[model samples]
Target: MANRIRASFRKSARSPRAGDGKHRKDVLDSLQELRNSIEKLDDTVQRFTFYNLQMAALRVGIDLSLFSSLVESEKPLAVGRMLRYLASFGAIKETEKDTFTSTNISSTFALLGFQAAICHYANTALQRAFNTTQPAFFWLQTQPEKLALFQEYLTTNCAGMSTFLDAYPVREHPTALHPERVFFVDAIAFRNRYRDLAGRVVVQDLAPTLQHAIQHAGVEMMEQDFFQLQGIKGAKFCYFRNIFHDWPDNKARIILQNTIEAMAEDSIILVDDMVLLNAGVHWQAAQLDILTMTMLAARERTQEQWDQLLQSAELKATSIQTYTASLEDSVIEAAPV
Candidate 1:
């Protein structure tokens, strides 16, 4: 009888009751759901903090530029002296040594081509433009001041981009096996499109202007659509940076197909763009993707999406390499097979 009781006990221990099993599963499911919620909350807090810091830094930079150009000129001036100097320039009404009114600072900055200040005053304008409002494009096109300020901002900030491109070790890659020919193609044709308004803006004679520039750089000037590349039969390799993501999958496929057609059996195509990892998407890339969506109906892509697009274009992704620049933006080097 004791042996029979022992056997029954063992069996009961091995097999849980139905109610107990349901309760255990419920506990585990609750725990997992709680963990996922906590993780999402953490991500939200991190993103908010990052944006806050970026905005604060931008504000400081703009205020410094506006109040006293000398603050950024040769040396850092005392805040008191800077405020006094701004008052002399009629930028501020009555500047206190320790603190000045935000309104005064903002007004001065707006007049001085500070992007942060312009962004603050033109909040509605920016939101409209950046959020895909119908009137936004009109504002950007018709408002000369807005366009001027935007260009000034680009001129100041674009140096970092230029430096990154300059320092990129293009020569390290084996030139014998894969010679590189940099081709810059944009819708804007004439250099006058970039000149200041008061400058001598001549529109006539754009072809020679482009030819001269390319000849100076020892590059061929081809007015071919990137989506339909031709005469690239003999090229060893081709590279397109920040181009593919500007279009949707179908359009990007067309560009990729053209690139693939241009490649020889052993040739490579390097695409420099974002490779959004599964771990965490970078904030800058995400925000830029939003802006692109608003303006051009384009977006950023992940590695898997890129693979799918390449395969759809009848091309293969051989490898992908990621690198972080000094700035927040990361660069992805993808090769085509």
Candidate 2:
């Protein structure tokens, strides 16, 4: 079966390109079918052997400095048998009998392999391998390029999705009238979305993140640690977007408690996050859940779990306004009980 699949791939590689995207999709579908077959095998250990083999190859390649040496070499060095093995998988380009050149894929692997190695050696706790003791944000402070990439992701992440404003009645809320009391966390996207709305939006984060936000005008950027007490007291709205999921319930409770202390009787906390279903979760949400778990030992919550978390923090969810149905992304509106 594997031989047949390999033959199919060889045939497709030689085939003439079609005008439309159909040909490309057909190739992708065939590849996916092969992957699906591997995953569907009943022997779980054997199924995982494919991934183990790939990882072993990666480890061996790195240990021998195969990718870097090839990428930096002025002339192709004498290739090893391992080079031919990797070349078969398109990791490098085979030139002649025992020579190879680095491809774009191999070059990228060479560059990123350093970053991966750094992370791997720095920390290892369950699946959270980024750093020990410090949270993700703090750990990122040491990595400027990674921190920028993370901030960029947060800023443009809401491009096509239905924003919290579309689902939550922000305009009708009493807080809309008093913008001074609206405290927005991770203000990059939020400030742009609510620009026309009344209020001096105070964006809070660690000192490093606030530095980025400070360059932008209109919104007030404040250095804040959410784990500590929220600086501004009795705000009309204390909004957090995609923040809670980075923490487990214990750590999340501390953040909520701090926010609660700064809230007025009529104040609301808008938690913009995915409210996953109990069953048949969307693939995107499930992927994010796994990511959070790996990154911070956290998990995305179901509606019931959200309710329980809020209740533990002495807050009640007033409404769950789902703007994006496909990903179950919603603005969980809650207030002090």
Candidate 3:
């Protein structure tokens, strides 16, 4: 059996097909299952967080048809299903007359994702599970909430346009002499930061989405294919925000090569994407691990994987920073080898 499995693995490994291969698909599928299991296990121990408990209880309210009962009878659910209602409306509430009602807040809890999360833990007791107890290194490192500081920047400063909505606010302001020229390839045109955001912010994209956001005269916006040689040569930074993950490796390589051609020896190819850590992967990264596959025919990469890809393109990672817990803004600062 072991020999047969190894032989099968070898055969699958040798296939020239790109993207999802038989063995690779199996591995990723199993990985998704494992992460889901881990998430389920983690939920059990997070009850002390109060928010989790509240959400869990609300899901029970849904499963018991408590919301629907409250709406129909206009009475508080003493006990059953939140059906025949949109979860976004609200969860059921108890009134002064011992009747039930719902608020917008409860509606949030009733959302399918939230409801599913809550339902998963219904009738379940907290357990002393090891998976839950494991240190959330990824969460601790990124502290995603910090990115909220720039939340207002999106509307007031950025004019509410970007590739990924929740784009990070780059603190590296532009200097006087060699103002940084940031090439945002297929990213949100943050028009606000163009003047001094690390330097002159240039946007390279073909999407009509950026037209409105390209308000500033100083910020350069280009409607060119990234597969071709990018315009800005010897730029201080060529940034691809969540762009590579949406493309297969070969296509990603082409994009990288194009960017590489325009980069200086010292120019940095900053990849603002997820860096899949080998161990202790948080649930967000785990979900994204599969999201890339289903949503796009692409895959997120680990440090080793990234290194291999960069090396193949004659580039190297100089520094890496995890700016967000969900890895929404993790930066892989790379340079030509």
Best by TM-score: 2
TM-score of every prediction relative to native: 0.43, 0.61, 0.46
| Tens digit of per-residue lDDT, candidate 2, span 64-138 | 888888889878867544555466456677777567788876786687645376335432343245535776766
Candidate 2 to native Cα RMSD, angstroms: 15.1
Candidate 3 lDDT tens digits, 65-167: 6554554564444421121112212344434322346666555554667666667664332122322332222222233443343233335532322333244
Which is the leading candidate under lDDT? 2
Superposing all C-alpha atoms, what RMSD in Å does each candidate have to the true structure? Answer: 23.8, 15.1, 21.4
* lDDT of model 1, residue 304: 76
Model 1 Cα lDDT, one tens digit per residue, 73-167: 44333453223323322344333332333344445464555664445742222454366453343445555666666556545544334322333
- Model 1, position 165, has a per-residue lDDT of 39
Q: Rate the local accuracy (lDDT) of all candidates.
A: 0.47, 0.71, 0.55
On a 0 to 100 scale, what is the lDDT of residue 180 in model 1?
Answer: 39
Query: What range of 10 consecutive residues in model 2 has the weakest lDDT sum?
Result: 40-49
Decreasing lDDT order of the candidates: 2, 3, 1
Task: Please report how far candidate 2 places residue 334 from its true position, in Å.
Answer: 0.4
